[model samples]
Target: MTAFIENDVHAVAPEVAISFFKGIMPFDTLDEETLRSLARHCRIDFFPKGTRLLTADVTELTHLYFIQRGGVKAFLEDENGEVTLKDFRGEGAYIGALAIIRGTPANLNIETVEDTFCFLLPRDIFLGLIEKQASFAHFYLKSFSEKIVTTAYNELRHHKVTRRSNEDLYLFSIRVGDLVKTLRKVAASATIQEAAALMSEHRVGCLLIHDAVDAEKIVGIITDRDLRGKVVAAGLDFQQPVQTIMSTPVQTVLSQSLCFDVLLKMMDTGIHHLAVERAGKIIGVITSHDIMLLQGHSPYYLFKEIRGQQQISGLYPLANKIPDVIRGLIGEGAKAGNITQMIAILNDHILERMLTLLEQELGAPPVPYCWLLLGSEGRREQTFKTDQDNAIIYSDPEDETQAQAAAAYFKAFAAKAIDHLVNCGYPLCPGEVMAVNPLWCQPLSSWKRYFERWVSEPDPQELRYATIFFDFRAGFGEAALAESLRTHLNQHIKGRDLFLFHLARQSMETRAPLSFFKNFIVERDGEHKNRLDIKKQGLTPFVNFARVLALKFGVNETNTLARLKALRDGDWIQAELWSSASEAYELQMQQRLVHQLRQIEAETIPDNYIDPADLSDLERRMLKDAFTVIERLYGVLDQMYPVT
Candidate 1:
């Protein structure tokens, strides 16, 4: 490669510095103040071909390079004085992250592939930024450096690849207003032909429809499909008002809302486009096309497909495709929790759609009701498609006759839902903790009474059942009902010494299979002999720990990691312990998921029984470390809420 400048000729005008970093990774999310600081420290450097920018044997690292316009290649040196090309980095690529994070010498040699213009950050500033900015840390955490390079190389080597935009990949913190830059608008009085013309001119699929009387108020939206269907299919007048073809109440997301939640709402509503409202006024529009990550077979698409199904037959195909989605996410190096969380959300969509189908078949219900999820589903952590652990809480009727009628109505509803779910591959919950069971299906008043009874006067059996239900979330209908129930339970049960004591006692039933000495205590004499049930042994202990911790500290988050973060943020637990628990939980979940995926690949039923021997030296070490963290947390639990 050739360059116009030498090492000494490295600098850029201050005016264009911020704009230059606006679309780059790790820099796009930084604020103006931070960006200025970066600009102050940053310098522009040009390197020629065969230039040794960094060497594998260097004792120290000095700069972090961001490729501006050309490419850089990384090489690994062998025992001989020769080096092999390990990976290549193109535009927007980052180097020196591994060295900076490790606080050690550079591990690979980096050279310009061509005349490369690079934006360079001093090693100290780069380290400081990642340490202070959680977003920067998380981006690196979510990506594997070498793997990223490999993916880029493969895509470069093969066919043309469509890449995610800077906003989609790195602008998780930046708002919709920042995302879209401009809001497209149309008057409600505009004709269909006029709206189509406007859309065509703008090269957009949809426009936010404004109110006729109040121009500032966004009342509805019209899409290209709206014109094609609501206009042409129905043979409507071309001069007719656009409001007739638009979708109303306008599913609006706050302009300040993060892109993740924005995508989630789009997924949940199956609305491909949404209007962004800032301070109660429409400002911009965002679409599924904008967020390129939501592609084929993604959770969002699956949920949208689920919502479209009018019956169970169509749902089978969507539900069956879930495993493939999970596999795809795993292949993409998505976080284990994220894959499970997406699965949980998709499963809820299936149930919600099924409930909608049932309600339609049986007609509207007699009262307000909430369909609650229990166990892993409630906690938002699920792997394999599993049985239903759900219950219903309906509003109490006035008299005994009305109660009987209400019971009759819900009983029929529950039976159909359970059977439908079973046909869709979600088995009827084995423990009879299903909505079809009268005991689990009860009036809202009855639910309150039951929770009070369970906590105030606990039994071993009731405690076991209570633990399963405590992680409650609404899958469908009246989500507020679920939230109200949680608030009530927390108000009464949190910090009640006697209740927490019993709950802790019940939670301690499962023990971690590994010891601090790094020895595995495998089950010796069963169908799964010499195999450890990692879910029961490794995960259950952490679950119990989180449940008790959340209850004790009044943290309302149901997920284990969420509870730990809440506790740490609230100063209820030390940072060291919280970090340990969080890491340990992730490690266990990741290992369990890999094990299940292995089973699926082998064409065998996926399960929790894992042999320590199957794990590598690093995995074995991680498993031990995770177990040790749990054991320490257990010791803390034993001290705080001693059962004996």
Candidate 2:
């Protein structure tokens, strides 16, 4: 195997190459000597087109290759010489490593489609190096565990989809303990009447003929309809092989396929049953009945219900059913994130209806305006008991008088809508930050002035406005109005280092809810005495960190999670940091959901505060971990943007 020098490999976009190395095995935690040794063993080799590096039938492997450039395709060929493409590997991926490590023949044939350059290391040398280097061994084990975890997660998600589709199709796999019909061996020349008698004796809807050693590889299936229409109706001889009338070329799916995908296939083809295949062998059959029964209530009906609501009052009933809808989605095994997104969509529709009704009650606005959603609503991460945190932005007025008139008109309209939303189940914003607040319903110039004042001369009181108002997402109105405001803010905040520093410092002000000993830090005294303020302690920190990064990076995205992802993708923050922040956000949101569910159960209004006594030990630990992530992120931000 050819080896390449580490310096040569590092020469290509060195920083990114180093990052990729640090993220993977061996190099991730290698000592200087181990790193040097590995680098010495690593040789970069080039393969021309049509080169076969590994074949399925190859019983031994001496080296593992890591692709540095170009692409390779791994495929399997059947007896008929038809090749099935399994996977494609390119840069930053290991090729033929699994077979080399597992000491098995390659499950797939790897061939270069074009000229490819890769780092090669002899299997024995790499194994010996890993054994001698503790850090290398640790990194390898961790990498393997992570891969297994990721693969398991993907499989679980796939299975969930399959299980849900099974319910929708009203299909069920026969259990070993259940009484099932058993058929004796039958030759291809077996009489049709004899097979019919056996099927009748078994009292089954269909007959499975066993011609091969593997009973599951059913050569033919005879349903009652087939017997009646093909045999009895035609007055055919009873002493004929069942295969003569059996359906040929049966369709099949791998057990690994998602259920919903299978359901879609069945629906498209107008077929009920699909044979389950693994490694080109049939195991069992999944029927349409199985899929239908497994599928829970469809969300399409809910969408239709929302669309059919004519007035604001009509939305009240649907809004009330929102919790049930979420519960149904959860029951159907929808991912928490996906369920939240769907709920947000439904909430948007309800809010839209309220806006429509408000517009009818109070005539159209005097000036072009846009209704803005703030906080979680703006982020589309709202739960069942979200509050109204919105504002209105109209075009700059021709004069002060016209601006006042436009602001007043929007304020009144917002107030009406807020009231409708309250009646529909959403509580009014506690901070009075809604559009109904006279300070919020303003012209474009006034909004810009508000933002400029907040940015140019930052104050503790105004910082609150900056945090919430900065996250404004267009809920309703002229799209251009919001865009113009966004453009203005983006332009003003780009080089304003002081503003960013202030934002970062302000973000760190919210002390994480854990004490020195890592115990819960309850509220000192208030209406929520002895309670943990989840919003103030958990959610706000992540929100602040994301906001600071967004401002510094001139990222136009408003949603906190989106901002975090954008920053990570833009290379502003490391992936691990982004992942930690995201996990913290998700954990906090889940806690908030639990709190909301409890409130709904008790028929009480949900709030951000939660009593520590109510939390389980596991939840308390997760909460602490979430806070720690935020605390670390705050430290990073502090270092990046030091206080003046």
Candidate 3:
């Protein structure tokens, strides 16, 4: 390996090295003085194809190499000699930073894929820059999760008018612990009057109730509203134990949790207070007010308004506020996953209120039923534009007359509920896959039969149904029915390898839209010419692939991100592969969301189509990287289940 390498003194030409470094990131942020210093210390080396630059366990990495020309392949080899490809680094890509920074031997076997030229910064020079330059060091020191999100966010901030300044944006970065200034606790045996008096004296709106037997053990929570509603409004005795009106079990968040996540949790659960804990000990309390005080706009308020509204007419306009809330969250640098979860929670609130109003007007349900949120909604991945993909699963009927009654009541209930949702801006499902569709709205027994048949008699058409229906989650009603149905579905598919093969084959049908030259394979001529269907080409492959693997492993998570995490946790997928796939999914989601927001601003219907030409150079490059990751992910599926 040393014999094939040659040094070139000309590689450190200050002007050329500075220019090249300026084009690549982190280095691009550096001052001319630092770049010159780096150039002066750097040496360029040439290696022939098949040259081993660094081998795991065999070589110690001494320098960080910035690829100037050609490429290298990084992989791992097990004791059995089975190899796993890690990544391919080309021009503008760098290597050995992770190893050099961590002061460890190379974890990957790095070899030149072709005759390659690289500018090498010695260990001393690398460490010097890491210590002296904050920005350059941050790029490498940040965790992969933070790096991908911040990279996309910084790009967004550069392109858009993000209303919040850097300082204001920092509010979202504050942890739950940082916001906890007080921890008020009351014994469960305390009278309601005494608890309210303590709250008043302390100027607190809520108190964490601890067990009389174990004062440190938080048992329940009682808020100002609970005093007014559960005590005064209900005409309960003021001397009654606080436990009479207190709610259990107390909601708690880790001290390390972001205030942004805390706000989302409050909104999702319709709660106002959360206990903050550090190292398993309750330390303080953080409320919605504490988080809301940091920002002018909050979805928590909007979520509250939706929950308070009783009439469908009033709820109609609240749905329109979702886009503005999403925009505010994006401006505040909320992550793609958090934003999607917020959207799902807001949508669920609106639907829940809508159904409640229906039950009031049309009378209570005739039988216990579960309202199923299917497809993207079920996965909690809704964006700006989504139509209804819902279903209903009712309990088994007791008799023919009861069955007739349930059928009539739900038929009318689903149609009216869907109409109200439509008035609130939800479009109808294009495939008629909503609660109002008879095929989708059925008894629990029928749903079980549907899954059993689909699993045993796997076909392309049934696989399509499996792709959508398999992601069902109970949005409302008896959730037990949904859980029972899931158990039944998993049971039937437990030993069914052929079903998994068919599902994998279905996933393979949609390939990444990249070509041989690494350019986008977009339509040449049409209304959508030069535009890529971001959903079908970019997002579907991930959704499909995650679903396929989740099914094969009997992982019950419905969300793509959650499924990927479960797979990684169960050791079903490699950690590196999970990281790549997760980052790719998130980056693509950010692109699609920004695109949809732009369309909404233009007063046009939001869509999944994105024109690569319209994207900034940074976004386009990241998107291409995401696409490359997707293609590699499919390779794993291919090796598992070869589609002939």
Global fold similarity of model 2 (TM-score): 0.58
Which scores higher on TM-score, 1 or 2? Answer: 1
Clashes found in each candidate (C-alpha, N, C closer than 3 A) = 1, 31, 0
| Regions of candidate 1 where Cα sits further than 4 Å from its true position | 1-184, 187-193, 200-203, 209-221, 224-262, 275-284, 289-294, 642-644
- Tens-place lDDT per residue, model 1, 480-548, is 889888888888886578878878766676777765566988988989888888888888888888888
Tens digits of per-residue lDDT, candidate 3, 143-192, equal: 44454355556666446534644335444678988878767899999999
Write the residue-wise lDDT of candidate 2 on 1-644 in tens digits: 32222243322343444544566655677555555555655566677767777878674666777777888887766467866334677877776555665577775678887788777767987777667777666555556435433332222233222233333322123221121123333444567887788767865555555564655556766666788999999998887777787665567677666554565466445555566666676666665555544535544345557767777788887888777556544434343455566677678767766787678778877788888988778777788777789888888878878878886787678777888888888888889988888888878888999888888888787777788888878887787988898889988887888877877887888888889999889988979899988877878888888888887788888777789999999999988788767866866776676567557767887788988786644356566877888778978987998765
How big is the positional error of residue 297 in model 3, measured in Å on the Cα after superposition? 2.3
Q: Higher lDDT: candidate 2 or 3? A: 3
| Highest-scoring model, TM-score | 3
TM-score, each model? 0.69, 0.58, 0.78
lDDT, model 1 = 0.77
lDDT of each model, Cα atoms only?
A: 0.77, 0.69, 0.85
